[model samples]
Target: MTFNAEPFTYRIAKSGDVHISREGRLVVMVRGNAAAKLAAALGNGDESDQQLLARATGNYKRGNERLAGSKRR
Candidate 1:
């Protein structure tokens, strides 16, 4: 599976809240120390930052696994 983080974007509110959005839709609003930490981590806006955003919005994989079985021909 491949992950594309381009659709994720964030903005810092005046009250120090981090507003995370995906595809132009708001996903989560982070506040307090967590918001500060997230803001710091998102500085570079690289792959790792994307991953952090994904995790913050509960968009990451949940560890459930199952390989596709061979189809009967």
Candidate 2:
């Protein structure tokens, strides 16, 4: 996927320290937790919180419908 370089930013933080970067996607690690891991658990990459939530919700709903339909067959 192609993203606009000027329009996107990445925020990396650990504890109280934070780093802001214009790079699209990345991994920020502090101790054992990384931003990339957090994003994966939430679904996809460094998308905005709202965007990730919407995508995850849509994926869940679609998966549920698919499973339900399969079970009915």
Question: Per-candidate TM vs. native?
Answer: 0.75, 0.20
Residue pairs in collision within model 1: none
Candidate 2 regions with alpha-carbon error over 4 angstroms: 4-6, 16-73
Candidate 1 scores a C-alpha RMSD against the true structure in Å of 4.1
Q: Residue by residue across 22-71, what tens digits does model 1's lDDT show? A: 88999999999999998878878567777888888875566654433446
Per-residue alpha-carbon lDDT of candidate 2 for residues 1-73, written as tens digits (9 for 90 to 100) = 2233333333444453223222444223222344355344542444464343333233323445557657563
- Candidate 1 ranges with C-alpha deviation above 4 Å: 65-73
lDDT of 1 at 56: 87
lDDT of each: 0.81, 0.38
